[model samples]
Target chain A: MAAIQGEVSWFCCGTAWGPCGTAGGGACGTCKSGNYQHAWPNTSDACYAITHPDTCGLSMSRRGCGFRHYTTNLCNGARVGTTIADCGPQTDLFCGERTCCGSACGSNRIIDLTPAAFSAIGSLSVGLRPCSVDTV
Target chain B: MPQTLDRRRLLATAALGGVVGATGLGSLAPDAAFAAEAAAIEPGAPDPNFVEGRISKISGHLLLVLGSDTVLHSIRITDGTSIWKLHPTTFDQVAIGDGLYARGVRLPDGTLAADSVWVNIVNLHAHIAAVGRNLLHLDHKGQRIVAHVVQGRSAAVYNGTPAVSDLSLLRVGRHVQVLGAWHPDTNEIDIATVYAAA
Candidate 1:
């Protein structure tokens, strides 16, 4: 599939530090802060209801558990390959908000990675970054 | 369409299995790169149980957020809520402007009674412009970003391999993707993982 452009962020699960404790293993029951995993907006129909990428005019496919997605930070061309550990980054909530670096700007939060996965491509403190998601 | 892909995957998996069985490598390595793309869900669909945004206001245990799409979210934190900001923290650690991703139940009032909240996290791709002592100069599009290497915290992956602590494999002019913590209002970031083609 072609690359899908959007915003990317991080989430925590498994045995982790601080507030991360509240996060259990994600919807997949396999997520952890240390795994190379991510949360995809379209994993199932129930997940679609919450993320509602349609509300924001974005079309995402319904990939199931263990699906792999390569998320590339548009700003730096840095990329990370992660498996789907949970469902996430509800798209409709922040439909029009934009995050930019240099001349690259992307709107909508489409994915959320675990700490281990997130820290692999970008910083966690920055909160969000414009990214493009692809299959390989 | 997914069924078609599944059939393809099954054939690939079978071929890989045969190869692994013959070589006694104890693993099946098919066209993993291609498989990665094939496993994606239908477009526009997302996981329903999660929310992402920034803190706009806080009232008691309820944290008000403005989503990346400019939607407002009122997330409630119970004693069961786990909040993370760089590290495991408490509700007091959360502040306005802090970006968050909360996973929990969506209540009838539209508030998400969160179970876990991770604040200020980012994942991006960049080109390694230069490397220094504990520092990597990166180019993200037309922008220059300085990423600091934290010992024991930073790792690298070469050619879709497992992550390792040795970052010596990093080279100048190589395109790499980074995952780390963003230092608000700066071009600096903390390096977590650097993926490069070995």
Candidate 2:
């Protein structure tokens, strides 16, 4: 705790902080004392600012065409954790209780593309003939 | 001392397959054909020692079979035989449902040290009970039989429709005719064909 001013790494940085190296391979001279190298994942539409602001909003809407009956829940449940449905009841090609968002034909179920209407999301693939359906 | 005695008898059983010591001493699938095959395997032939058997259970490829006198014989098709003229690859080609036949040498412990094992080698008209992986578990009238496809051996579709190069046609739920070899040690029948039939 002496009176050494310009001798420490922090003391040197206390001035105009040195250029910070971005996690991306390029270097940024505007770095401050506490700055560290980090890179943007480049997945979203916007580059992450120094404050890590989320420029890309949520893809799925809460009440719009993006939300379907049990479709999102099924996929999310399948990818995230254990699913309680017997996938056969859905179809042979897929696993779970919910069918794809589509239309229904004889010897087949419904097939529709309500989710694909979202501008940011990709269109759903063509639905197939389900092998099993609950007979009512 | 029975283990030692069994080993001694087993070593004696390796005498060129000519030991004819006992008629029904060993073998899992106890069929009259096995006696003929054993006799056929005795004399000079190209790899006559090879055969098939059923897995009483599996701990890896090492299967325990109720072989020959209902003895739980430990068997493994390690380093199986193949005919490069017939099959290009042998890895993961074998299963329990497909018929198979192997012609090779026998070891002292009553195991088939096959130099060449053929899948779907023998043919039979049998009823299918269950199907799992290369194993077509079947019941021939009153007998419990196993039709297996060896790793390298190919199978013939239908009963007389030449041989099929692909194994995708084999299914587990269909009753059919199979042609192949029987290995007593492993208690597996090497399958050549599987479908709707006897």
Candidate 3:
């Protein structure tokens, strides 16, 4: 699949504590805060209805649970591979949101990685980073 | 530049050794080690090795923290520990009452041997409601925030480009993710990096 450019953020899932305690096992019922996992906005019709990437004038492919995608942190050139474990990012809420590293910039929030996957490519403290998502 | 390089080298060496503050064989990167440690915790559970809270006390290299959930944590800082306040700093710069997020190894005694700690760091997603000289009015989650741009320190990254100090490209109505230092108990923040589209 062609690469999708957008903002990437993180969420804690699985059995979690504190504010993350309510995240549960995600939409796939298999998410873990420590796993290399991610949430795709269009995991299902219900998921797509909520995320609504099209409302932001972006077309995103519908990928299902366990589908693999690679996310690159534009700031540092760091990358990680992860599987879909949930549906998320409520994309319509933050339409027109954009982030960039240099010449590479992504518009809108497209993907949310698990904490373990996110911290691998970027600092959790930063919360969000410009990213490119590819199927390679 | 040499000093920065040396510090990075030291950190790399420490990470490669997989001994942040205790003896262990793990990944060759500090983040990798942290990921490995996190995996050991039960799924959907609070990470045992990751602690987030405010520093209530600091004695020597140890930090006494009161978690947001009311849990108490003892975090031990080591030479290998990388600290970031606004920028990369030393342990001494970590002051009391600063909020922090630490990732490391949880020792058998329940103390966390921190590999990395971020103090007063906040990453916010907001829209540019207005722009003024050296400042931006942000609307975050329906709340207004005053974000100040620290000259020379604040940078902007446009369209996946390298960061630059010029922020004139920021436009009202555009959404942005800001990484900066938060003033305790305030809606104000000092911008470190602003990521947005041109």
Cα RMSD, each candidate? 17.2, 28.4, 6.9
**Residue-wise lDDT of candidate 2 within A52-103, one digit each (tens)?**
2222221211121111121111111110001111001111111121223233
**Sorted on DockQ, highest at the top, how do the candidates line up?**
3, 1, 2
Docking class of 2: incorrect
- What lDDT score goes with residue B149 in model 3? 95
lDDT of each: 0.66, 0.29, 0.73
Model 2 RMSD in angstroms: 28.4
lDDT by residue for model 1 over A53-114, one digit each (tens)?
Answer: 99989989999888988888776665767888888776675667666776787877789877
Docking quality (DockQ) of candidate 3: 0.19
Q: State which candidate, 2 or 3, has the greater TM-score.
A: 3
Q: Tell me the tens digit of each residue's lDDT in model 1 across B1-198.
A: 243233333433332332212123212222111122222222223434356666889998788987644667888776545465555577898887776666555565677766457676545555789999999998764678888888978887564455798998898987666766556556777777775643
Q: iRMS of candidate 1, one decimal?
A: 14.4
Interface RMSD of 2: 33.0
By TM-score, how accurate is candidate 2?
0.23
Q: Which stretches of candidate 1 lie over 4 Å from their true place?
A: A1-136, B1-48, B87-90
Instruction: Tell me, per candidate, how large a share of the native contacts it keeps.
Output: 0.02, 0.00, 0.06
After TM-score superposition, the amount by which residue A84's alpha carbon in candidate 1 deviates from its true location, in angstroms, is 16
Docking class of 1: incorrect
